[model samples]
Target: MKKIQLFIFAILLSSTSVFAQSDATKKADKHFAKFQFVDAIEAYNKLIEKGEGNAYIYSRLAEANYNIFSTVESEKWYAKAIEAGASEPEMLFKYSEMLKANGKYEASNVQMDKFASMRPADDRAVMYKANPEYLSKILDKGKKFNVQSLDLNSNMSDFGGTLQDGKLYITSSRNASRKNYGWNEEPFLDIYEYTVAEDGSYQAENLLDGKINTKYHEGIVSFTPDGKTMFFSRESFFENIYEKDSVSNTKYSVLHLFKAKKGSNGFSEVEALPINSQNYSIKNPTISQDGSIIYFASDMPGGFGKFDIYKATLDANGNVGTPVNMGQKVNTEGQEMFPYVSSNNTLYFSSTGHLGLGGMDVFYTKEIDGKLAPIRNVGIPINSNGDDFAFRMNEETGEGFVSSNREGGKGSDDIYAIKKLQPLCDVLIVGTVLDEKTGKPVSGALTTLVDANGNVLASKPANTDGKVEYIVECDTPTELKVTMEGYESNKVAVKGSNEEEVAVTVNLKPIEEIITPEQVVLNPIYFDFDKSNITARAAFELDNLVQVMNKYPDMVIQATSHTDFRGSKQYNQGLSERRAQTTIQYVISKGIDASRISASGRGETEPAVDCKPCTDQEHELNRRSQFFITSGGPKK
Candidate 1:
């Protein structure tokens, strides 16, 4: 096959003959150098028949078969080569790669360890020596994310999902009407779209259109935010363009990136990207947010590996820039593909190059301080010993999706839903929402939380006992909203930290739908102990005032900041001013008009609970923010 032939050539270029040679050996070397691997194998076997074979012969044979992905034969030859006292470190490295590709990771690691000791300066060897326990770590990390196979998978190959406008588009070989590909005996891949329901179910729809999904293969696709601009991979044969190798009588169809725009009817204005070539492929398009950047996997000449991930720039009018290889930090001398950049700018990709449980595994990388950190395997559940690729996630809910052909699936290469078991941050808030007056658990209260960007991070319904829980990033301000029909809707504001679990209690007041005459009373706007930064508990307490301001934008509210007896009067006065200013800023950040609210510091001079020799609990009660209506009071 072309796959076997190409891999053979790669092996031929790397294999060594580190032994004295004869006429037969020279002939075999010429055959191997000419990429005539079959002839080379026969010539080497003839030399063996003449009882003139050495370790070099066996090693080269192993390399040849290994590159062609002939697992059983390659393993047999490698064993023979080892028994013949082969001492080449590259032989061991290739053996390790072969073992890993065959899912024999323990054996692979052993071989890698041997190779590393022989050539410590080798980059891959150095990597292994630095983290000898990488396999165990990857095994442990996989447990943090849980995965489930989706029902939409068919008996045929179905994988590669991209969600846009609530529609999940995937590539599949399930069409009975399509012709089979000679390479894999599978049907040509077609883009299939599924309407994702509100309940997270997928219902298969028709092909995107006749333009994109042609008779030839159409692989993974990516779309811009507006779902108007699109980039996808297509078979070169679709355009009647391919390079014919006359010697092998084989025509190689180049996969290329195509850009298309959505019009009122369907996808049209299709044009091939300028970077596509007949010699190299640039496929698996993943457009970043804003459509200004595109990440893809390619074998585009200057790549560090077989298929290196690359990025290109796109302007407002879709003018393209040259593709840049992702660099050796993220690429190895092997195949890398299916790059997905998440909403948070974290890069997720699948690679056969990196060390993994086996096969292709999903990995993530992010730049910190302008340098890419070590590439991380997303861990188990998401990556199996199978070819797990096409990883994607929604940062808001921490829910992810991936495609894997791991055993026990509805089909070959099924889509999976990945639930993030690990929290997004070190901070967790677990508490209950209840009625302040009766202390009764508020059942069926709706809760929502917002990040500092004022984006709704999560929303959930309160369970029995009014229990509610959420996880947010450290040093981030989160606003948690809880609302019931009879109770005034309130928010719990929390500035998160590494504190594992912060307990918060939301005691909602059961109030009439309408406000009454006297100064509308609210629970104390709390502050953390000896600190002005808003506490998680106070965020909850202040959110109600935010709701009031939103409901009646014309109303004016004033917050009075106070402190307990821990400090001097003057110091407490300054601290209370900072606290009041912070409280006012928090209210305004929630979309409330800043002019409608004001803050003043009433120091320890005016304590809420004025008790001498006050207990710690009393001190906590005294450090609070009190609110009063400055204008637009209750109607008389």
Candidate 2:
């Protein structure tokens, strides 16, 4: 359930206690501020029964139920609050979320539309307005994974599973012997272990080592690559760390991460992480494959929401540095938790932030340029209109586990085994650069992978075989640009299927002209009738000569211009000389030496296609330019 709004609401309620006229209001406000939502709901309902309920009381009841995931109750109270003239934008937003959670999608969209109208500038509102049909798009994503409820799930909340060394470690509230937590009236969470047989079956579950499972809540656990070091979350009761609430006169213990070393019997040498603080909670730790960095969720100050994913460097001596927030790209003004990094460095996490079906949804992002790429929802069977989280995957085997609290489960939350049918947008692009004229490999050509907006994603020089490869998002508009010296640049669109490979061939035309004993041949640079200025077509042909001149600096060139038989000899000659001078100037502007170029005019005197009473087409073709190598040749 989302609690950041409750945290804000609690502070608001506590500060405005002086406005309370009834003892019942003060009593309920204190309970709500201290997170004793069960008591708060009872007290708030009592005021409503006595006909003393106002918009304030209704909003309080709505938020209290929302913090505890009472979907029906919260939805009911939110409607009442809105009807009672509660103008808080969050109330409408949460109302829509609760509607989605209960599978009332049409009602949800109605409420979301009202919320969007209220706060059009908010990211949530903007996203909704931009893609109101997001649900249909999400449904159309199809089933990317097949999910199966675990056989060992008990009639209690069981979630957050991680596998290592043929064992699955998960957190469960199944221990009836433990005292119940007031928040959910369930036994405190404890980390449990289950043996996995090679036959793809599970053995009986047991409590994790005594050193790790304490009386207070013991949440998820993660192991290092070698499985020699373990990190897990526990309530701060063991460390005697807590904060006292003035209103409820209660001392609340926050969750803190602890690290332990593996021994012959079990994990021991338990110690709290340095990032732990009594002021806020830090939990759900997952380490990278190299064991050099740890990723976790924290509610510490400076976070974007109730919980935000963070990473800290782990030194050789097992010391953790200051935590760094994963930034706004991966976090939002909602809870984000249960971050798992796959072997290939794809970071999978759960978020109530980013656009999703509903509740906390599983999202994945790849690392690009030491930062995260855009987040993508796993979609369909892997996510639902429920609190789906604690996602971890084995990329090599295409199997993984996820936890959810959707309908038809054995408990409030259950861990489900998932087999990936396909990836959302994993594509491998393979291509080769070749010469257009020769159909041979253009070795050492530079190739770039760019997005639809021309942003470069990756770039590299083609290998000796003219082959290049890149991994990019599928179904996204992308293009491959290839360039080589003495060759025209080429670009082609890249399209592929998810998790599939596609082949592309880029062909570049040669730009360098063949150095001949006489005039250098090039595409005809046609000039308009009676025009002396260089056109874009003329400039294009002149650029070829500029490239040739630059390639052979000592080589000199004579640019001669010709005209059709339509004009007088003197007039045509003057226009032709002007055209020749313009060509020389164009070449010089392209960084070629001016001294190596000379201009001349030949008016109707040297018509290669001589014809009496020529057609306009033939006369137009006669108005062209040619380049003759005056001195110097290609170096031997």
Candidate 3:
């Protein structure tokens, strides 16, 4: 009797275990079907705790984690599922996508390649592995950001401030002494005109007869590029007709785009846009400068996520076309709304998907050739851990504005202005002018700073120690030319428009001179082997010669060319003549008088560094060219 009772007890325990496992699976399926991924994950975790979770349960948990944007957690579960014998192509593809999104490019490529092979050459997997978003990786570096609240004081929630005709048009929710019809139990926001004084103080006044402010949430406003049309969001609540048994009317809120014609009476009647607003919630209409494209925030179907940004083209008949989703890169699984498209094709929007300080942070993504760049967080003081949204910047001045709920604010939300500190150019060019052979100081070296247009902006001379220091102010790109007698000049072009200071060391090569019986030395012109092309280095050398000629004003030089005895005498002579002509041409190219340089070829007639009866390397030293000052210049 005891044995039979124990067998019955074991059977009952096994039945209970099976029943619990089945119940857990059913609950997980129901939660997943309702798009409650967090709940589904919880159910899957309970099944795993009971030791009833198979490979399918682990795979489902991974999918749930990925759907909720928990990339790290999804990777963890996907690995567990794979170890538990789950090897679907879809699973591999999703794992690869997660890796790619997390910037694990090498691992992602390996998985994607595997998926492509298993799926018999899937184009998407192949293309993704081949041309991964490498540029996005570069953009992700040094992206640390922070947000600090400013001293912008306003009692009401103020935003959408734009600079127009030297004044600021700002919208505020502070309605004083007006009809107190609460807009959805909230104060109605209205546009106000403010004049920014030269001393940086603002005097604001309400515009229009309070007609634009309805008893609903109406903000997120902008004007056309020409300021002739005002575009804004208008909210209206309507009762749903599908619920017949419901006692209380179920009110559904829809955001509609409205335009006001600007004229003598300020703004005319506001009219609803031609686009149908029956199924989708469209708001925050921002038209491009050309009036051709309208960008707005919507929760329409086919979007990558909740409240993704969409773009609609205005046809010739002024009707908007079907809106297109911005894409998965811009729109994440979390809410991506409150778009503010600049005239320069940069889209600024508020997103909660990206790692932010807190709540929705403002981000900007530039569109180049129809491809959206990686979203960039407009760093601190503009965005914080708190909710920051509705970013607007003046196209005329780079001054920016953002609404924040950070600490020390007067209310729940306040509009703050971002003041950009102008970049300063504090670069100093310091170097010693030294004699090339002895390394001794060569004082009185002339230094000149010129812009890209070759116009001299500043000039100074070397000090007693042959050290010159110039405090050149460079707000834009410019060049510097340093020259001294008996030394090759140096010209360096620097990019300093965006940098604070740039320090450079200039090492000038020695100028060649032929020492004659009268204490004269022939100046040699060097050329690259087998090439008569004048490079920038050659040009710099010629510029120094021109400066010396200009100083003398009546100097003439015989440009002579010679060659080593490697080839026939006739061929050597032709080559030598061509080299001499090239030197003369370069001198003339530097704006020097062409008649001043007389070209002549000596072939192998003269050798400064003698190579006769020497090795081939020594013979090569005889190949040379020199410039003889024939008249008007005195040696220092």
Candidate 4:
């Protein structure tokens, strides 16, 4: 009887422990399912401490931490889950991303390799295989902005700042009096305002008008040029609109746009936009400078990715038109969010679909030929291996704001003030090499970029389209040199100013054009005013005549020099005679047979451009030398 009672007690104790573990697991699952990641992380961690953790619990913990951007914690739990053979294909991808976010590139690549093998057709896997060495190039990109953290940030999530009408509007979850949000255990986001001084100092931190700040989430705001109208994103809960899950009896609220009128005291007359639907989310709105259009992000049906950037036209009477997708040029098979339109109508947004430095990166696209151009990454300092979004800028001010969850922030997501160091400092030297006479592409032409000091920066051959492009640093004096066999080389000077792109056309003259039937026509040989000596430029032109003569040993040349209508007739004749002698001597010095070259002087008898009142340019044109092939010609 004693042995029976002891065994029964042991069994009861074991049953009780099992029941407790089940309760803990159930509680953690509930929190995670509700998107209460903070609470779920706590519950899952308790299970691990009690030595009852399984692969499922570990993965949940990893996902929970990842949702809140707890990089170190997420990486740890993901590693553990992966080690225990709990890695799903999606889990492997998440683990790889977490590894990259922590800067463990080698480890991330290993996980990515596994992911690619498992999901060969996934876009992420395809991107990984295509550019396995993208990290170095991303890191080497020049910094375009000097970013600094804002002092107004709280320990909670604070981001999405925009400046309008001398007030800085920011979205924040810093109100301790409000109800906690299950997403990250912080208060629900509200629109806050700060008075911005003329010198860019912030003051009078306070909540926005009660009409705009509701108990539900309110996000980034934009205003019209006249400051009489405002547009922003708000949770649908304010309108009591949500979709209920039949199984869990839970309601999901989607984000929608709202327009408000600015009254005498505060913003009022708020109304939901017509484009709002219970089926999808629409948020991160930015209005055009003229308030005629609004751009945003959404995950609506028929999109190319999880989210895509969209825009809608707005009328003066506050009516919005149908939303149109930005298309594949801007959207991809991943998340694209937080669309911001600059004063100059440039569209900037954050994306995970695009090739970036492992996380959401900001990119900008502008209209070209009435359509959106190919998007380009905004580059580093404004972006990182963390979620970077909510980019707002005033192109006139050269200042902006960006939000990021990168390391060393005071909160989950912190707002940063960005001052433009320089506008992307990359000058694109792009052009086509063409025949001078035919205007057709000169294929196989070698194009080189040279700096002011004549150092070759880059070289490339023209494509079949006769196009050659090189990216050089802005604010540097550069030149584009195009060379091809059987043609005269062409050099175009480019003044590397603030312009981002400079287009040029290199017109190459055929080598046969040099040896005309009558004259070995070189470029104008220039002599300074009242000077008979051959200048360096004049020497260069004279050498071409020598080259033509050398190519044909039997060729003899007659050179004639002329003067502008400036000096006395006798003096002009003397000057022209001396210039003619100098031109002949230059050719002789270049190994040309002195007997093969003869020269004469014409004192302004023949004028290229005849004008009663000659302009400076016309005068310079008349002061030139010409060479005629007196004998044999080039072998053609």
Each candidate: what lDDT? 0.74, 0.80, 0.61, 0.78
Quote the positional error of residue 421 for candidate 2 in Å: 2.1
Writing each residue's lDDT as its tens digit, candidate 2 over 1-636 gives: 332232222133321222334565888877776667888899999999999988778888887887777889989988887787775666777888889989999999998898889888776777678677778877887898999999888888888778989898998889999997665567878899889988888887788767989888887889888898889988887898777777568777777899999999888999988788877888889989888999998888998867899999987667899999999878877678889998889999998767788888898988744546667788989898888888998999989899988888898788999998876677777889998898999889989887765557778888888888777767877889876778756678998866687889998777654557766666677665677777655654565677677777888899898888887888988888888888888888888888989989887889977977899788867877889988885755
lDDT winner, 2 or 3: 2
Write down the TM-score of every candidate.
0.57, 0.71, 0.44, 0.68
The prediction achieving the highest TM-score against the true structure is 2
Which wins on TM-score, candidate 1 or candidate 3? Answer: 1
Name the lDDT of candidate 3: 0.61
- lDDT by residue for model 4 over 109-180, one digit each (tens)? 899899889989777777678667767756776787899999999898888888878899998889888898
Candidate 1 Cα misplacement greater than 4 A, ranges: 1-94, 97-104, 117-122, 424-636
Question: Which ranges in model 2 have alpha carbons more than 4 Å from their true place?
Answer: 1-21, 117-121, 428-473, 476-491, 500-636
Rank candidates, TM-score, best first: 2, 4, 1, 3
lDDT of 1 by residue, 488-585 (tens): 76766777666477777787776443355534456776665667887766776676676666666677987888898988889999999999999899
At residue 547, candidate 2 shows an lDDT of: 66
Of the candidates numbered 1 and 4, which has the greater TM-score value? 4
Clashing pairs in 4: none
